[model samples]
Target: MDHVRNANPFTSQSSYSRGSVLAWRIVTPVSWLILVITSIYYSATKPHEGKYSRHTIWGQNSHRHTPFALNSVIASLYWIALYILQVPYLSSLFKEDNTLPLTLASHFTAHNLLTFGFIHLWCRSYFWWALLLVIINWFNLTFAYFRYPKTPRVTHVAIIAGPLAWAFVSLYWDGAAAVHSHHTAARIVANVFLWTWLVYGAFYIVAFKDWAMGFALSILAAALGVGQFFTAIIALQWIFAFTIMAVLFVASLPVAAPGVFGGDVFKRGEVVSEDRERAPLLAEP
Candidate 1:
């Protein structure tokens, strides 16, 4: 009873092995650095031709000519923001007495490796394979999201929810490319899939109280709307995208904003400081 009462949720380290902590401390940064270098390399070396070119989307040809595609510039900016958030999250894992849970470490490693594979496959015009990678990444990130600690909200966004949002959006973008079918049935299915963003955003917000995921989806929806609008001025896809964006943006406020609805959403309330004169700690069993 005393041990249970004295346990600190934020700082408990006994469950982790030293080797797991050490390995991830070295592996995580190296994997992230590799991804950065390769992304830059692919973006620079791949030449822009046209829709049929191997470097169709990432080169000077920024437009993807698809309803579900996000504006390339906006997508790039989102990735940049995600990467910047990752720096602090990765650094936090290296703090003294911080033990990396095996489950999180495994998912993190797989997500990074699959992401590395995805960039290469995507640049090579292997849309089907890239879509496969994104699917795996989506499931892996979802598991990581639930497994991860919720406090210190920035890291939660950085490590799990943000990447999950990207994966969720990429499913449509990559799936469209993989199919590349102009049949009315296929087009109808694609249009229907767009609404899943709204469904997913709503589910996360209500079920998990995860405003970060909802916000990420909202921003991505806006980007998709921008792309769809420029692709076809008369189409309703852009209108649908924008509507989803508005709905998610509004719905997410309760869990994120502070007042009657939200209270210290980002504050690490579990981490009690010593100045508060906590009860004396008991040795772990």
Candidate 2:
């Protein structure tokens, strides 16, 4: 695990120990608790905006609905496809079969290449985007907090911290496995992390309004386009597939928001504030 920490800024901290690990596990649930409480508070007191409610494929608004319905549908489909693709590989591994070494190598190689390429091409972009989103969302949530200070603060905290906590857990687990040269463990952990991200991406697409989603999607598409171009240079189809997957993940983040394919017309929340306003009214006669 020291090797894993070699590149981390937190290397000076004590190595993760059984107690610290246990503490993290114990505290992780607090985020969930906050999520529940905040959800309830928001549900009870927040003004319901029926026009912005979830819409059906036919474009009819479904009142009193959460974006989770659509998110669940898409996530379920993705999960099924993922399981179908992975089960055979896992079964083979358990049976001590190595017949698919090339396939496995190709899969992992593509992932590694794509990850590194993306980091090289878009890590700074993603960092800025993520940073901006974090700041904006924090500001918006702060407004919500001040406006309704009595509302359980847990939910807002959970919403922001949940993904981060999971990311750390995933990194720690994967890092430990890699440190021990447990390739199988690392692969499994990585797959689990990917699946979690896939679901989160789905939720983002289904839950956010249009402008936010569109901005994210555009950035993602551009990144993938660049990543795929590099993959072409390397002559690896798997890298292209991985890049597409990454794009899909990015597109999903803002689907749940207001607009989407329609662009500015569907923008919502503070995004509208950040955006330039439409042209001023013409001088009246």
Candidate 3:
């Protein structure tokens, strides 16, 4: 009983590990903040509803000012990439002594591969890119369940990086006129992607030992999940708004819980591993 009961939720560790997590998490709220501030400014200062008003309908295409849009891009990327890139930080949580971030060099270029947006110029407007994102989302969900074999770590990057990069490209390609013409069709797929990101991304964070980060994340999710409704991004109306608000709020509340991969990590409120070895701790039991 004691052996099974010994898992500590806040298992103390070297400053480096804790710092890595903290440093990375700092971007979470900041990115959200930038989004919030920019969203408000973007909406408030928007050109009075004339020709541009059509584009204003969808939050995706609303921001036109290059500087504002670019700033939003930077903050948004930092917010998301911090957590997604934590594939290394995540590996270290179950292992010890070794640098979780370092394991990438052994495989392929995880960091560079994450910059999938650069390809937008070449891969413009093809249905295949969207299809590829679908594959990547599945890989992320599968990896979240599996968590080892480490190959999925790169795919995890694809989870967000792929969609986000596409968002940038698609919105650019769609332009103001196309946005009005295809808002419904676009939202159909975009909503699916939104929920998918929320799902896998939430699961990834919950898999960690950081309860505080999870809770903070939840608060952000709730506010933004609800806020998205006001932005008119998803045309499904109140049901969609209420559902998203409820789900996002819930995601951050529990770090580890029963039925999460049928594991006791959360129900026990434990860290699950403290195996301070130099090599990455590939074994999880």
Candidate 4:
């Protein structure tokens, strides 16, 4: 029998469904696959046409390959993001050492803050907003870390949605212009990839399972797109990014599927570990 937990604001135990879990399992990675392919195609083909003009979906001349500086900056951020995302998986490698996850998580999250600040702090806007939301995201996880049994279901929703929503909103703003250069196009694709996670996060926001895959995949995808941005030939950098991400994606797939991530998976951990109820063990006397 299923051991249903306490009520969340948006859903009850009845909200849990195997169909939803399976849908997410199938949809989460597939969405990233589609986005990555489209991004790679755009980065490869569109930059070659000898034209100062390319009509975008928003009807802007969105095909001018901008200078390398913009992409270089964006690309650096992506690398940093990838590094940060890797920490969790690596923590699993350190599972024999119990405290390693905390040490690694702190180190990387700090690195993320510094790197993230350096990248976007100088921007015209969105710094405070980004940092604040990130703190909230971290708060959810921190709470789950220290107080799993007491942490409510709604908090898990926050953990699931926080980063995806922030990245999604930020990326949506990316398309405020057009995808002229490798940088612009990269940002746009990052937005769309993140948008997929936001949709997946929505399922968890109400009530669902296996949030690890959606969360990890979305972060890695956005990081890949960010890392891809560069002043070099679009094709070269895109291929590099795609190759690196393809490997990362495949490697992470099993990790997410099994919840092998060292840290708290989805704030509440998995079902069996978290459920508070247990029936009599056949009264084996």
User: Which is the leading candidate under lDDT?
Assistant: 1
Residue pairs clashing, model 4: 62-180, 68-231
Ranking by TM-score: 1, 3, 4, 2
Q: Which scores greater on TM-score, model 2 or model 3?
A: 3
Assess candidate 2 and give its TM-score to the true structure.
0.26
**For candidate 4, lDDT tens digit of each residue in 50-76?**
224433211221223322112333433
Better structure of 1 and 2 per TM-score: 1
Score residue 63 of candidate 3 by CA lDDT: 34
lDDT ranking from best candidate downward:
1, 3, 4, 2
Q: Report every candidate's CA lDDT.
A: 0.72, 0.31, 0.37, 0.36
TM-score of 3: 0.38
The 10-residue segment of model 3 with minimum total lDDT is 62-71
Q: 243-266, model 3: which lDDT tens digit per residue?
A: 644664565445444456455544
TM-score quality measure for candidate 4: 0.28
Residue 161's lDDT within candidate 4 is 33
What lDDT, from 0 to 1, does candidate 4 have?
Answer: 0.36
